[model samples]
Target: MPTPSVRRSRPAAVRDRRAAASRPARREPLSTKQVIGLILGGIAFLLPLVLDVPDLDDMGERMLAIFLLAIVLWVTEAIPLVATAVLVIGLEVLLVSNQALLPVPEDATAYSTFLGALANPVIILFLGGFLIADGAAKYHLDKNLAAVLIKPFTGSARTTVLGLMVITALLSMFMSNTATTATMFAVIIPILGALPSGKPRTGLALSIPVAANVGGIGTPVGTPPNAIALGALAERGYHISFASWMVMAVPLMLVILIGAWLLLIALFIPNGLGIELDMKASWATDRKAVTFYVIADCVILAWMTESLHGINANVVGFLAVVALLVTKVMGGEDLGRLSWPVLWLVAGGIALGDGVGATGLDAWILSLFNWGAMPALVVVIVMGALGLGMSNVISHSAASNLLIPLAMGLATGIDGLEPVTIAVVLALACSLGMSLPISTPPNAIAYATGEVTTADMTKVGIVVGVIGTVLLVLFMPSIWGALGLL
Candidate 1:
């Protein structure tokens, strides 16, 4: 006795589900949007190759054009991330024929752009550190800490968020952003599952992801983008020490964590969730556990900054994960659990950014923007926006890799501006984790929890992203300028 409307809707719903789950056929059916982008990409590809265009004659111009095309792919979400990496690398190194990109003086190697970027110690350190983070999860240290921290705060959603952020921040200081995120996800799933299935529970469940995003700001290893920024800074001769980074890092993370916690309190629980914490089990922290955590962290820090021979940071980190897991210091399953997607994405980001730099594209793009004449404050704002905006489009590590070099190039061009100071702003902005689910690993991690929709995350991001950026723009001059970077 179903109505005509109900009968029709059922068939259509089933068909839609089938279409969504269908794998890409050997001959993929192109969407209207994809078709349009493909056409545009084709024109762009051919224009430089066939016409021998004057602007294209310069390597810089062509590189900028290609970067813009990558942006196009980013906007449309048409290509896989790795596919963009391949396209960018091939176009920048192999295809480029302009003499300017390959000027014979000083730097001359056939596969310079391609091979040179990979040879960078900073990139190596980043990859190595990520591998270490994967190893950390193989031991259950991350989960133990997460449980120890949040178990006491289960009474309210705000507490859960604050607890998660604090723990994640601490773990990230030693682990990769991706690994930190995965570990945190495992911890939260249990608590969220325990919540009463309703609107209040839903809001609280969403808060844990927000905590993770905020938590990522606390340390260098907390996220890959920060690691890339720091690694690149070291390689570029900035000499930013571990102690120096913490001064800015601690305050930045605290500001976001506390602010978000307050916001959650206001929005989700006016009177509070009225929940209780398990004090006997959670409050009982073993000093031995703390010692292990501290020792593990210091070792990673040494590996990151100090030369330990041919052993890379990733190797050291993974070994630490193994030590912890095998020794039963942390639970075994946690170390084995890691996110492969993030690891590959970061690698692709490294390739993409290196390709851009290798082409001298960043230098040329800076020329086109013409921001050298602007005031110091104006320059900072523009650069922050550029970094944050670009980060929104792709991964944060890629943004840092691109912007760090751009900042270096533009620093001298602008009057009396310290390059590292500007670079720090860009670096910090790289992991701001606001604006979109795609913005950062932490944001993406939070988005994937299903407690928060894209719209909800976006709303939170718009407000917090603005606040976070302003904090950097305002804080950097005082902090870095005091230290004389400005």
Candidate 2:
């Protein structure tokens, strides 16, 4: 027995170290997806040169096509987004060789457009928000917060869903919708899983997305479309602040939530089928982490709201990034691993806008749409419809980044509707939970729980999404009238 002891199997730490060193490097043979990604990547980078597309001045049309191909790969997720972005860089090289895309007639210059995207204020804001969320998770405050917050609903189904919706809506005022959902998931989904109570009746399924949608509406940074609209409008010198955004956004959220309540009641839940509130004391076990994260969130909110003197919205976001660096919530290496592809895509979109502006094509595109002469309400309806459809087809971020500039260009021709605001309303509403599984991340996230089906979301979401589109069109004019924002 002593001879066979073998020193207790080399101890857990030693065994772990040896096992890690001896590990077979995962040996992931190229998968079909990877193969496709490589082929497409090669085409995107190599095709423009062979095709002999000539670059006229700084036209960069070939680069644009290459970028499109790269984005297609990204959206398909055949490869990682960053990889797709790198493919864009490589294509930039080929396009430059043929003198078809590079503004500076060189590969390095092609990166100017892309690097511009990475350096933007909004992209940086995403980084800051992630850092804050990371700090929140590190201390396990998210779980503790959820445990304490979830205790209040007791066993009632409707109340539990309602509580989550309300909390998500409130938290989303300053955070991105995705980040808010991720945070809320940490707090809420576990409770859903642990329920000896079981999955929510049919009412529980629809209610979660409804709430998530409502919560996401009230903040400038809750979704990208909101940011795009806000940024484009601000570029035209319209000074919409956090408070001003909420003054309008709050009512929009209220209308949608009311509709959701009615819809939920009409479906599975009786008007009488209600949930009871819990009076249990909270258990925020990671009190220390919560303290750090909350302070950081407050700082961000203050900057976003411009509540403090000498600190504006854009300035605040950068400060948060700096805080992330100084506090070591995440390392530089981790930051390097951030979604730079999406960042580059944003840049590509913005550069496209800049390109259009430079070429006087923005004016031409606007004139073609002929949307400038339409009534404000008509424009609202059209923009809303376009937003919902395009978001469902592509992605919301893509639609806004691509379309808002065109709208901004056309605004000069309109008499009443502020081009940027209409764009904002359209862009902000882009994250609707509608018919397709691929429409929005929230739809996918909630659907993947396997508790809800795509068809269920589609049936209810179509009615609700259409209703939401109408709500925005009708409400914007009324609220803007009251606030004189239009």
Candidate 3:
């Protein structure tokens, strides 16, 4: 017979086993990629500190360290993207700002200047956009609008795919690509299930992400890369208003969206297969939802008519936030649901660009290349290609952050290269990078559905990305100049 202590010990062991079984599994603290990134990032950070480059000052060296560390971390995602962003700001304050721990120049940037990036105008605009998007999701406005708008294309499988693509793109223009893809997928999952599991399902799955990714290029608030470009341009005293961005990009967005739709139909969608969609729209009728609708419309209108009201877009964005909070349309929970990490990520880019410009790092880096010898068109093509290629493997905002400052520097070095043209090209090119599941969040979401294979996404993505980049590089600038859009 067992003693009392032994019996008690057995029960305790069982309890421990139960507890272990009930708890969620924990991931390793550092992945192999993360470990490699840390090692490489550390070396990159210390290189500028230990070795002096000719004509590069102390401040530039510090910023260079931060920039190099950022590249490695963002590429490998050793840490969260937002964490890297905040780190950049913190380092700027400690190493190069007016409050530097080391000796500094008289014109060192103010610490407040680095911290103030959190409230940059681009961030304010994104805050309003996030609030409105969240409210739309909460009120079921996005789904209802998509359902109602997709009715005409329900006649056939091909047309229904087109309709879905069109609605997805339209929503993505106003909402984040990830959100738009999620909302559309949620509505269409049943339809996708009803169809045979093959090319048709794959095509339908692929359409949402492709449309969302392409649609993001349509406006300033459509994507983070656009905000990155806008923030950089603002630093250079060149303001491209919301309407102006639409004027410059909507045509390309339409072209690419339609092309992708056609490609999807040809590749995966089979003809004569009828797709029956339940197109009933149950629009919200309650008082709170109605109030939200009014606020969103007014905010978007104000953003579009900045030329008429003379109220800065940033101020208008804040107005929307104040109106929503004051009216109780969105409470504390809704505010908490906003994409705070994204906002911080954009802030970090702004701070990074500011630091690079302040330290003359842009000129030092630009001096390494003979940009003036290249034709303006070739330079633009190269910048666009870099943005497109880098965005495929890293975060789109990260790609923009790394490239836009350099593009600005190139604008100064190359004769006849307009900052507006190069900056806009780089921004839009970043949006065109969706050739893989890892290219963008929308693509990742689409791949997660298990309806499409990586090969499926890669083939379509490569075609769309290449075509879109070619159009953007070879023709858009001429069109913008002809229309006086620049």
Best prediction by lDDT = 3
- Model 1 C-alpha lDDT per residue in residues 434-486, reported as the tens digit of each score: 66777766667766776766776676666666788888887757776676533
Error of 3 at 320 (Å): 0.7
Q: Which of the predicted structures, 1 or 3, would earn the higher lDDT when compared with the native?
A: 3
The clash count of every prediction, one per candidate, is: 13, 3, 0
| Per-model TM-score on C-alpha atoms | 0.75, 0.76, 0.94
For candidate 3, lDDT tens digit of each residue in 1-486?
876654458889899999999999997789999999999999999999999878998999999999999999999999999999999999999999999999999989899988999999999999988889999999999989988899898869899888999899888888999999999999899889878889999999999999999999998889999999999899889998888899999999999989998999899988888878776889889999999999999999998999898888878889999999999999899989889999999999999999999999999998888888899999999999999999989989889988998889889878878999999999999998998899999999999999989999989988999899999999999999998977
Runs of candidate 1 with Cα error greater than 4 angstroms are 1-36, 49-57, 96-113, 151-157, 193-199, 231-235, 277-298, 301-360, 398-404, 440-450, 484-486
Write down the worst ten-residue block by lDDT for model 2: 98-107
The regions of model 2 sitting more than 4 angstroms off are 1-114, 147-155, 182-199, 271-294, 304-310, 324-345
Kindly give the stretch of ten consecutive residues in candidate 1 with the minimal lDDT sum. Answer: 100-109
lDDT values for all models: 0.61, 0.61, 0.92
- Reference-based lDDT, residue 344, model 3: 95
How would you encode candidate 2's per-residue C-alpha lDDT over 355-452 as one tens digit per residue? Answer: 44444446655655667567867877777787777777566676666667676776677777776567666766676645666776666667766666
**Off by more than 4 A, model 3:** 1-27
User: What TM-score would candidate 1 get against the native?
Assistant: 0.75
